[model samples]
Target: PKDQRKFGYAIVGLGNYALHQILPAFAECRYARLTALVSGDPAKARRIGAEYGIGPGHIYSYENFDSIARDPEVDAVYILLPTALHSAMTVRAFKAGKHVLCETPMATSVGDCQLMLAASKRARKYLMLGYRCHFDPLTLKAVAMLNGGAVGARQVVTTDNSDINVPLSEVAHSWRFDRSLSGGGSLINLGLYGVNGTRYLLDEDPVQVQACILPNKNPLFSSVEDTVAWTLLYKSGAVAHGSSSYTIKDASTFRVLGDKGGLLMDPATSYWANRVSLISGDATQSWGTPQFTLPALNQFSAELDYLAECVARQQPPVRASGQEGLQDMRLITAMYESAHTGQPVNT
Candidate 1:
């Protein structure tokens, strides 16, 4: 018998991530299922829908997206479009009387984020941010350890999220390089992992933000930045340093330090496997590094199930709420401001 209790999700984009990660994750989702697909390309939509057992009637284009309001099977819409389009799509989903699960960096501007939140409130629909790490078992384990004094007193965090270089032709054609579509470049797209991950681990918002654009003379970055670095100051005297680049092959890694000891995670925010090690020392023992082996959980599936559970219970998402996404955009905006003015901005 089918689990009719599962929430139905209408994925609103057919991008690479949506097809590769989000769609596949549905198979592992305990509380959610793919009920519909929205894509501008009819061929892709039909093919994907057929593969997922979604009939042509459930396949929608951007032009007919609002008609989903009449679809009882579509209890929620998952917005996986580019950063700038997140706000508008979310608002429309709310108007259609559907819950929303939007991807991170929320929107291009703070005002856009606020608008999405207001729309959700007005429509009385649930809004969840796609901060997948919050629901990952490994990340949750790290957070629990840090909070449990595994690292005595939190002191510092450093993270770098960079990817392999892209050819000039591809870079020029991708929406990620377009300022209007992406808002910025590597910092907004890649560095968000570092920023959001640090904040979640520490459970504290930065008080001040300072940033600068790194030297990248490539013509590929003309429309947006290629590399950037930022520093965040916490009220507890804690500090975080982060950097990201589109031209660098650096791994997505973060190192957390405390008075007693610290932990380092290489490939921390990767979609696949990750590594974490604890470094602690005492007078008798120089230092001991222990590796942690935790249960593997699909990040996308965990987050989707989490939001579905929240909606099933008619409760707000506690971990990755819309407000959490708004705060990240606010901090990102401040980072941009700081990088432009060469002065620290109060957040």
Candidate 2:
């Protein structure tokens, strides 16, 4: 028998990511539903809410967000706000007696991540980070293959997560271009996948970080780095190389090479259609390239159900918890520091 109860989620911030990805995902989630909508725009919220069968009473503005505390239907809040607002919104949600699922780069800094963790502890509610890749079928398969010694002991990893096309007009008005709102540009916005991805696949943290932010001549990138490249060195004698850029054509992929052979994936972190290739064999025999048939999953929906399942079981989201986000923040902070000092920073 399965738990028939579906947990209700109050979607905070009806931004593009929320509207395009998160909201659509609810339809596929078995244990989660969009019971409420929180947006600053009443008209937009009400219009969208109506489409989702959310009544006007369940639609709330940012000023009235705390009122959700009394809405028994909302068991949790999925925070899709800007990077800087994540910490505050998560804290407020917990204070309102609700579990929280916040998007990645948890907060602008390591300190804010700690604050979120503390608030979740005080509320005794679960705090889950939106590391959707963890639930992604393709990502899980790749992790399993690498860790299962399909490629042998992982020695080197390389990845690039970037979307180079952005009109200057959009950049001028987007909060992502504003440092105060987004924390950082390309790296935090798009590159975080590689930074976090390598760690997940290896099941280990980097011991040292060396990084550099590429220079941009464009005026739009004056406030933030247009591109960044980083290296993560591990104690297991493994090295990971990653890069993210707003000026490069679409490139989202990761390659893992071990002593025996290697695995490669192009378009690896996309919302759909991720493919993988593996080359492995013994020195005494010819190499074997096997084909695999993998099922595709809605990344957003899987992540939503993950938290709902945890809530139903009255347990913490240990797999993608706040601590995971905090660790990434620490690594990111170190990368920035290393970039500034022109030296390898120990993590």
Candidate 3:
């Protein structure tokens, strides 16, 4: 067994995101230890608990989640539940005296995000948002280039990301389509990724926002939007135009244009490291993204790894925290408000 580590973690939910992303990511993570599994399904809990070698005591059902706060074994908890359940679960976990590694979209509303933040503080726990993309090597390199003036003055940022791959028919009857369960739809679920990235690329939160949304033809799907585009104005005179869609193939990218030259990172996806190309002067410099050979560290893995380190070392994770999620919600809430009223949102 590896030597003892700090920040032992208990993961809640055993869904696809948890199975595909968080559970497998434990190998690459440094500070976090996988201590327990929580699921509404006891069979799933026991099965995964056995597979992961978690003690039976650490296994919990949804009804008994509150009892986890008193568990002596777990130092932190990772909430991998549905996007809608994030707020209540996070707040409950925080109040239970566990350091929290909350997955993104902190919540659908700034109010809930604020409540989560308050709970974290009241519990005197570290609450970090799981935004691992910012920690990826390609993203880090892009940030360095931004700091080095490679993309000088960063005038305009144009982003287009659409995934026709995820047919609504798949999740039509699921919570993802239930407006109450999934919140606002593609604007909240998919589009928020673009919003988060905009802050990272610009190195600033958006001060203003304007946007529009559209729905593709999938009658079975809820009335929630399937696609959206928004313009965000930063305090530094930089403007970002971003879009995200699940009704199309994965066409993801973030391009920053400066007074000098622009930097491009295209074909970026949630599953893989970004494909980056820096175009300057007449020559374009490029760096290959890390293809995990042995450990296969996905973005979710990187996030937990960073969270463990941050908790042990008393440092901040690369991206925003629970409060920052509140900030994003504020901007997004304002954006939705603006879209409804045909006015510019002031964040």
Q: How many residue pairs clash in each candidate?
A: 0, 0, 4
In angstroms, give how far residue 331 of model 3 lies from its true place. 1.4
Off by over 4 Å in 1: 164-169, 282-290
Name the candidate, 1 or 3, with the larger lDDT value: 1
lDDT of 3 by residue, 145-243 (tens): 787898788889888777643355576656667777667766777677778777777788878899887656767545567777889988888999988
Q: Model 2 over residues 1-347: C-alpha lDDT tens digits? A: 35766899999999888999999999999889899999999999989998999999898888889999999999999999989999999999999999999998799999999999999999999999998888878778889888889888999999998874447668788888899998988888877889888988788999999999998899989988888999999999999999998888788989888887888877678787787777765555332333564788999998999999998888899877899999989998899899889999999
Ranking by lDDT: 2, 1, 3
The models' CA-based lDDT, in order, is: 0.88, 0.88, 0.76
Per-model TM-score versus the true fold: 0.96, 0.95, 0.91
Superposition error at 325 for model 1 (Å): 0.7
